[model samples]
Target: MCTYLHGPRQGGMYYFRRGIPAPLRSIIGKREFLISLGVKDREQAKRMIPQYTTETQAILDAAASHGPDTAPSPMRAAADFALWQNKQEAAEYQYQHSMEQEEAAIAREPLVSALEQKLKLSVDKLSPEEQAAKDIIDNLKFELKLSQEKRMPERAGGERPENSSNAKGQLKQSGAAGPVSSAQTSISAMYEGYATQPGLREATVRQFRSIINHLINFLGHDIANQVSSDDLIRWRQFLQKEAAVKGKPRSAQTINNSYLAAASVTFDYGFNERLIPKNPVALVGKVRAEKKIRLRSPDFTKAERKAILSASLSIDAGRRSAQLVGALRWVPWLCAYTGARVNEMTQLRREDITKIDDVWAVEITPVAGDVKTDEARLVPIHEHLIEQGFLEYIDACPEGPLFYDPDKSGVGLQRGQYKRVGMRLAEWVRGLGIGQVGDRSLQPNHAWRHTFKTICLEAGIEERAMDYMQGHASRGVGRTYGSNTLPMLQVQLAKFPRFELG
Candidate 1:
């Protein structure tokens, strides 16, 4: 029989069947009765209950309505719903698997990780200052990476597009941002220009050239333009590795000098040429070399000076061409007395020597553009120069070169001729078993300047006046009025005992 449901007096529904048991009827509340009656609202529930009861009564009256052979099982319907859910779950899992495979393929490519490896190696070997420079390079690399990622087109539902052949090409092109070859070219040009100057020698140019060339060769041509911050890091690694391989990792001082020379010239040239907007090489750190100040005086001892002069006279007597020997003998002794660089000494002329205040003095006016450091300076002659027949030598010519060339055919003392003479003098001194002349186990013309400074310092000369005498560029109080007066300089110089040269 069909069941009918009706609402409670308080507005909830209840279900009932015709001739149903009183106990079952009491258990069915109005809410459950309305749900079973398949009516969503109170009005529908009231109407549906009476109609359902009438229809159930009619069906009950027919003998075939409740036949035992026609009923459907509830368990069969539940099994069908479970199968549908399994199909939906399998479809979702397949979609997720496809996405994971795409991500794995992108990660397998080599180009993505190459730049990162390069940077890590480069930064590992730098000093603190150099590491700061590497840091800037690293930032630039990061910028390039981000820019490349931004330019990539997006896919469906905010997913990133897979890496394609065209995208890889674009990334490769973006990676070619550094200008290593240009840097090398600029450095070569700078060294060539610097070597042309009178004071900068060819050997110095060659040494700097070697350093630049080595760096260029180390970074291969194919990857030269593609130098990222990481490539520089790798270069630092290469330098240390090479040093260890050679069994002399070189002092920090040497390596520092090499790097400084490389960086300074490269950046200076790049800045001047407007190549990269700013100097990239300038970020490298400086190397600190130990500074040792020797305090012993530098005058030739009485015996040593006598032996040098005696050797000089012997050479003068034996050799027909005494110009070189004579010049060496007098110039070094003159430097001992007057304190001047070999280059400065070679530029001396008869016009520079003058008598002031009834005493002979040298008027050293460094011609405006002639000085090595590009700063002009002046120094006065000492009484010892006059006493040692220097005045007599100058008087012989009066207007030409004080140390005139009898053979007047070649260039005078410019272009390292004076340096050659100094070398010869060093060889001669070694032959006579004299004392060690200079540092580095090589005879250098600069020793004379050193010797002068040391002698003046030991004699208790004022530090400022000594600095002025040596043409050292120093700035401070009292030094502001560094006078170029011969009388004033002579007064200070006269305080030191005359340097006897035999």
Candidate 2:
């Protein structure tokens, strides 16, 4: 008498519930399939049984044939789930709802008898063709009735489950297909929970997701708890040897900072939640790289500095969009004097440049975009920048961001517009033959930050004041007590010497 129908919950809606086969659950990435029947009427719901059963079986068959090759992409899995759900809903209306002939005939008998009585006609007196059509309709109704009576016995028996909550009402699966234990939990599954943890930013969540996905792909399975420290060491080795051995991209520092860092935090989260016994990633050491002796400092060489500054001054506005031209022209200069990150300058609004107590300063605030420390600081503008018409450019610009147009950037891209400005500027600088340090490419925008801090220290500016201007976190409890006023920052900036572009 089981109908495979569930609910009549608070909303009085019914759903067709079925358990996925245990062997295929890992591949499909779910324990069961729950398709809503979208009806209060038992009869209407019963009519949908055949189509739902057929479609779901086909989906299961497809997954079984493909095996683990069908393991879901974390980025697209939610979207795919929604799309499949929509397909099921659309299929409901599209089904022909064809009835079995014998069942159809039996079901239609009463209606046929009533019609004959009302019209005062007998079937025996009908023409040959009319009689033939009548016979076919009777046979179809008979077959449809028989099919439903067999398929949905609960409807035929005039019975339904008490409610959706009861043990008897729920669809049962094999023992292996029951709730996944923490140790059996896949990294993809754990990530679903980890991704919702508070205080993580959108960019951070995105970065973590990418790292987890990469790990999943490399391991060929999503099980995080089972991954030992040995597995992690191998992953590090693979990343470092990727370029020469596997034809994949290579990085040693990135392997430590990004890859291992992401996995370590994820495992830590799992351990804290008691989802895993312990964090294995914590045991793995960083990837080792051969040391390269640098002839010059990490800062941009003086010739490189002069080339970048002089190129920025000559950047043609006619060749590029106004935002790109603006970023290319002034961001380098801003970074050179303030020691603020490149992104801080690229995200600048015209309003962010203000006169505080008659001294021009830039506000590196989270209100503009992401600040690395999530705190704002006032960076005093240098006299050299003012001399090079920086203030005139600010005044001439429109009301919004100085570097990028917000309107052109699509939804959820507010934080990324300034980032794109930095990217575009880097590409432009590369064209100018700057930012190269031997085999490595120095970050064009960041080179100025290194240059600025070095200049400040050499010019006898106080370290604390330089740190304050650059938005670096105060090192000690004592340093956190006082605020650096605009006058203090301006004094620090005064000592920074002007670049001789010749």
Candidate 3:
């Protein structure tokens, strides 16, 4: 009877289930689509349903409307799903492998001692299964010995011993021996290991790799552990002396945040994984920004805010996609009131808009896109927005994302698409000739977050409430203890003064 859930199968895992529409089933070559949600918990499985439903429904609707010729072929869909499943499984395997490696390192001495004791004590009394396990362990020990002996001669510039007893095969299968030792692991290899950490987005992987590539290019050698503090410092100096982009020299902030931060984080991963002995990059002190750069305000000036808000209302719907126009119309206003990062507004789904006990609210959720804090929060719909027919706008919007069409988003990378929406909006704002300061066009989308904080302070809104509503973590550990309920937020939001856009 469930719409998209079928399970409590053998392992308590749930399956995503949906019947193919009768008309399109023949074209798609399936009666229904069923795939494991891979979650054992019912609530977690249910939370996953909307995304699956949206994606599956999108494909089905396309096939129905455009026919099989225009829509994705069944094979293409199957291939794409297979690729995603493989990536998910690979990520899981990588995490498990990493944990096993760490556990082996920590328990090595005790485990070997215990195994030796066990082998000395009961041999004939053991069950067949236990006896089999003991035999495998014995083979593993022999393989380890052979692997070590094979490497010792190679280190002494002698030929490896030819194994007669399947020692080489066992060593290879058991991963008791590898070509790349921990000390000699390349930076690229370390990145490959680091990048496999679960929940890392495509964009993040690209960024980290880009930064690490710069380091590799500078160093001339790629060994991970061989990187020293002086090497990092020289790279820092090189980056500082040269322009990373355009003709302008890389700023101190850029050097610190992007170059050093990336190196530190990636090397920390390498160090933790035993690929590297230590993180040398961490020893490099923070780069000091120019005084002017350090003092610059990220907030939009009053005139700039007025210009942006005014421009939002007047975007030519004729000139842009309906989704972009809708985003141009409302996202700025949402950010102006809520102090939300622009992607939060752009990723808004129609379902995220709802009334909480008579007060209308917008749910900023990670399910829509990446929330920086990775937690969902509700920002009460500003009275001014409601007055401007925001609810009416919501009523007219289709069932999914209010701003961008996922179909038009190219890769269906939700984070990337939503991020592009914010970027596009910033470009649109720049087109209006606002936020232009010297060579840099100020961060048009981010300005709202800064402006919103200032507005809250001026309106005497409590910092805690502002932090909660804006999806910012509380400053102190003690403040994280309690819940910030909808009613409480709504009451706090009422204190915000509505913008006089006239």
Candidate 1's displacement at residue 375, Å, is 3.4
* Per-residue lDDT of candidate 2, residues 1-502 (tens digit): 4366676432456777777697866554445566666687777888777766665665566566664433333212222332235333433433221112112232344455545553444776777776776677678667755653453422211111111111112222223223224335567666767779886555556666766877766665555655766677678777776762124454455565556666866765564454654345533555665685665565888898888889988887786888888888888888888888777888899899999988998998988887877788888889889898999999999998998888874444454667767767777878887764233536677777788888888999988898888877655446767889999888877988898997
Point out where model 2 deviates above 4 Å: 1-184, 198-201, 244-249, 410-415, 437-441
Backbone collision count in every prediction?
A: 7, 21, 0
Which clashing pairs does model 3 show?
none
Location of the lowest summed lDDT over 10 successive residues in candidate 2:
157-166
Every model: Cα RMSD to truth: 35.8, 25.0, 26.6
**Residues forming the 10-long window of minimal summed lDDT in candidate 1:** 159-168
In model 3, how large is the Cα lDDT of residue 126?
A: 74
- Sort by lDDT, best first: 3, 2, 1
Please, what are the lDDT tens digits per residue for candidate 3 over residues 1-502?
3487887543456777677777775444345556677778888888878877666665566456654334233333332233223223323322211211222232343454555666665879777776888899788667755654454423211111121111011111112322224345677887888789897754456666777887876775566656666788788889888854445677676666556766766775664454543345533555667766434578888888888889888888886889989999999999998999887898899999999878899998888877766778888888999999999999999999899888763232333566667768877888878655352525677778888999899989889999988877676545767888788888889999988866
